[model samples]
Target: MEHEDPLVTAEWLKENITAPDVRVVDATWFPPFLNMEKTGRQAWSEGHIPGSVYFDIDAIKAGGTDLPHMLPDPVMFSSRVRKLGIGDGNRIIVYDQFKFFASARVWWMLRVMGQKDVKVLDGGLQAWIDAGGELEDLPPVPVERHFTARVRSDLVKDANQVLAASEAGSHTIIDSRSPERFSGDAPEPREGLPSGHIPGSICQPSGELRTPDDRLKSADELRTLFADPMAPTISTCGSGVSAAVTALALARLGNWDVAVYDGSWTEWASDSSRPIAKGAA
Candidate 1:
């Protein structure tokens, strides 16, 4: 399938599997509700695409941040990418087995750092497997190449910034949590956080971007997904994880100003002083 942007389908990835300067990264992650019994590293060891590297989303994170998996420093992120066999010139194809989760996070992270040619593998690993693609018993030993990270600060925002925006009504906050969670009808997965979303935020469950078979929906469908009173949005979710998916979806649509609320609702609701809206965003 051809896209106007830089997405590669399973069939496209399979055909390009052996191409030079092409790198595939497995950005798989599970929510607290769905543990893989082991981490993605162990999963990669058991079996992964041949010549692929594992991009541990949680491990490569911003240190010294109150939130989980905040963006890592530019220098640190660049070093990590190089160690993973990625470079500025290479085309990146990222995917995750758990439908659409951390895969988009990787895609967004790379693109934010000004890597113009990165793309997500449509449908992730399941689609690859269904397409008769082969797998390997281990990840390839990568010869480290230089992957530079130019910090695109505009693409990210901290909890404080989001709080300020919520008060001033300067930007639309798009919460990627389930409707029940956003509405306070469901308890948050992370303890100590109050139920509900930020006042004035909009609810667009990140899972809406996925098709029935776990493939990413077409851009046309995505355009419809973001159509709401909420415009010019920032994305937030349970502890800033899946919220990145919302940012990724927006980025794919060329919303360059989008940001991921680093602390997300976990930090927001945990602080009783922060204002919240109990029902409907």
Candidate 2:
């Protein structure tokens, strides 16, 4: 499905936040390696956009997997989001404390689950504050809304599919990890996981797509960064979080065909059988 701009400005959200048909979601998250003292829920409890519910990426994930924040089943997704008062016909707006970080992951998750009108809050919480938006510690009591998941398989890829793309050279694999990590110079935050990237994948650090002010770069700039706008691309990151940033950037350039490798590096490196390549792509 063709989606309108996958982003909404803080001013736009501030104006429509109270609308019955709108739901604002806070997707704040911190990598486990950071050793953050406060969890995303704790951060949300302190202050958040008024009426916004916290969408914990870590909690709302596929069960029975050692993987970090893997996509949950449709039934789980539908049930969890329903309690957030997110359902059909409601426009969902997601934001994160760190600008465009975890919010894009949530946005991508919603999109892949077939939510027609999900968008990230451009510049995230800071943008909201800058736009004279107020924050409230009190959480809203959300009325349940039924959410139906018409899973969009085209938007997601598994390890086998990514490996085939890497071998056949039919698709472009875009790794969103940092240059050091992509090149094997830096150790992975996850212990015992070797550094380096998938064979033939190109490194496009997600941070580079963001401007100095924490907003995404213009579409023209993003087009240049991506090089080939029409390539069938699969975005991958340390786990699967930042890859959504790449997907969002491409979607901003009117390229919605980009698929995210859901398991990403963590999944790829976990198994010794997968081929790993070092140095530049």
| lDDT scores in order | 0.80, 0.91
The residue pairs that clash in candidate 1, if any, are: none
Query: Could you give candidate 1's per-residue lDDT for residues 131-154 as a string of tens digits?
Result: 999888865899899877777777
Report the C-alpha displacement of residue 274, candidate 2, in angstroms: 0.8
TM-score of each: 0.92, 0.98
Regions more than 4 Å wrong, model 2:
none
Highest lDDT scorer: 2
lDDT tens readout by residue for model 2, 30-120: 8888999998888988999999999999999999999999999999999999998889998889998875678999999998899978889
Off by over 4 Å in 1: 1-3, 228-230
